[model samples]
Target: MNSYIRVSLAVLLVALAPVHSLFHPGVNTITPDAPKLRSLGAQQGILRSVAGSQNLKSQDSLRLKGGVTSILKSLKDALFPVETWEMPKFFSMSAMMFMIIYIYTTVRDTKDTLVVSTCGAESITFLKVYGVLPAATMFMLYYSRISNIFSKKALFYVTALPFMAFYAVFAYFIYPNREILHPPIPQDLDERWKYAVSLLSNWSYSLFYVVSELWGSVGVSVLFWQLANDIIPVWQANRFYPLFGQLANIAPICAGQTVAYFAHLSDKGDDAFGVALQQTTVLILAAGACFMLLYHYICVLGERD
Candidate 1:
């Protein structure tokens, strides 16, 4: 029965993956018209408020009050605060994790959009097999090596700083000069050469996709949780872990909406890609910095106490 319960919990966690994926398609399709959607929602809300004020029957009002009450009750249960000084720590850690996960999902979704736009379906299939699997293998090997050399706190920097630098360089240099770096296709190339060229042409996008894939493993699955476990006591974890898990489940929704909002603000012309990349780069850096600062602060507090 204990083993069965463990398997059931694991399955429940795996099921949440689809919830995050559902946010991606909306970002890809609706981003172009995000402003219009927001406006429409606002108009509907206003109309509903006006109608309610003018002609709300007692039955309708009762139903509305019941719905609102139920929503408030659910919110209270989901976000119930701990009665301790560690409440700030719990909230800060939760917020930091949420930001890290949000950055990962948003960037991953954006990278997917670029990959599909630049390469296509077959390229995605090739990336899943040839690109990501090999990168994952190499990363694990390197990570294992460094685990012996560096403390866990230092290991976080060893992994994260390089990624941040690469992103900065890619956003500022490679992406903007992509066309210059990879010129138009020549008519004289052989068929096999042409296929190779097609894949090589999207080199930066492919690299972005690979790095984004690794971010989840390095940032969220490893570093963030490791830090959490190091700080939060087991008894406190029993109370806050479920709330943190719930916050994590809500993060992808917030991330998707943020991506859509930014995409809506993006320029309509050739500068759109650059603008989007720059914006996401800022967000990625900010999330990493904030997470590290909070991690350090929490550790200091833990040590002092």
Candidate 2:
């Protein structure tokens, strides 16, 4: 009976010893599942990243991780002189240029068409000499004086806002009411100097042509550059300007198509020009507003970066 009890105790000890080893392993014991746990954690991190911030705006700058895609992206960044975070800034500047050029094209085309169709082509030469020269001179003086008194941002608003507002007002009120606004002239007024007189008679169109010219010279050439230079450093601007120019070139094409489409809207009847003018003005105002917005955003980015 004693031998049987001792043998049963020995068997219990052997079985329990292995169970104790599992709960309290040796110092040098390696976890069998450690590698798999690490791999699963890594996979989950990647999945979380993929599910979150899909737009990549929140993504960390890609490290040069020796992958093919990473290497290509790095090269692209180098060539463009831009980081992932800088894309919005870049695109905003480009879009601003686009809007500027679009407004210019739309206004200029319509100006020329109005001049040639109503006042004769020769009147353009006269207006360029008399109207544009005087207006530009005054504007240059005004710009020079205001530059001293106002901040660049304020100056931009002063210079640009008036043009946009006047354009809107002209489209809605001035041009449409030109016949009533103009002076009564002889039906048989066929003098060579009659072209200039006719332009003077249709004074709204003359004013429109002059404003359009000043817009090209001042609003576009001066204001746009001022805004661009304010946001981007010269070193970085060189890389961006060429691309901006190329992208902005599309605006002219779009303007042409817009004009054509509206001009051909025979359903508008005799009011086609009026409808086109109003629609184009809306676009110009929208573009001007957006350009200012982008300028503000880029300025914010510049401050932050």
Candidate 3:
């Protein structure tokens, strides 16, 4: 089995290398800005005029608040709704959930994944897929008192509730119009069931449906990766991050495949179901972040026990 796997990988790499090379010939062969090429004919002249017109549109801007005092006032007003009202409610709910079960699950799941799959033969073993740097660090650090400081239950409830309430108030008022939450649908139901069984499911519309559904998930995933760089630690991350991150990158692909299958079963167009699936994931992540903050507090408090 091992020999066959190695042979297969070798063949796959050989097949892809030439294809990659042929498609991306070097930049040196490319011509510079084509000044002469711009005046091909009347059509080219019109194209250039339109391009110049569009370029002018790019220069427009708002020159509001010429000084620091006005800027400061603007900032305060922008933040006021969240700071005054929404932050409090969010934190209140967060704290309640934290007192119930936030950090416990995180720690438990981490331990389970680590202990169960350490250095296994599985194609995507937890350690190999996730890397050893962080996992090893987490195991080592887990025994340290400093790392455990935030692991207590009592400390969690004390620290979690107040900050969460505060953050929640701000979060709520910050974007009062934003509706981020969406509940999940039944797991067994497929989206395609609607089209498979219904006469009104237009084939041409399916193309638009699929494209719109994918654009959001993909576009947002790209945005989140940009967001992650600002907050994710460079070092000691392997030691700190949970085991599930090993499969995190592949998750979207797996999810797309799974949901596509479900859509086929449901008779709903694949695109429609894909959109719903991605929206459902976004809702879960938002809720999970709130819950995780509370859990952190509980873990700190539990250490006292």
TM agreement with the true structure for every prediction: 0.69, 0.73, 0.19
Q: Candidate 1: worst 10 consecutive residues by lDDT?
A: 23-32
TM-score of 1: 0.69
Question: What's the distance in Å from true for residue 232, model 3?
Answer: 34
The true-versus-predicted C-alpha distance at residue 257 of model 3, in Å, is 16
Listed per model in order, the count of residue pairs whose N, CA or C atoms clash below 3 Å is 0, 0, 42
Q: In candidate 3, which residue ranges exceed 4 Å CA deviation?
A: 1-122, 126-277, 286-305
- RMSD (Cα, Å) of candidate 1? 34.2
lDDT digits (tens) for residues 137-233 of candidate 3: 5433543433357533343343334333432332243223222321222335455442232211221122222222222332223222222333334
In angstroms, the error of model 1 at 139 is 0.8
Order of quality (lDDT): 2, 1, 3
Question: Per-residue alpha-carbon lDDT of model 1 for 78-176, expressed as tens digits?
Answer: 678475677778888888788788878887887898888877756777787778899999999999999999997788889788778878888889889
Q: Which tens-of-lDDT digit does each residue in 1-305 have in candidate 2?
A: 99999999988877777677688765223457767778899999999988787646434434323466877887886666666676888898888788888888989999998889988887888899999999999988988999999987788788888999899999999888877898986787768769878888888888999998888887568977777777778887877877777788899999899878777763457777888888778888998999888878777887897
Provide the RMSD of all predictions against the true structure, rounded to 1 decimal: 34.2, 11.1, 36.9
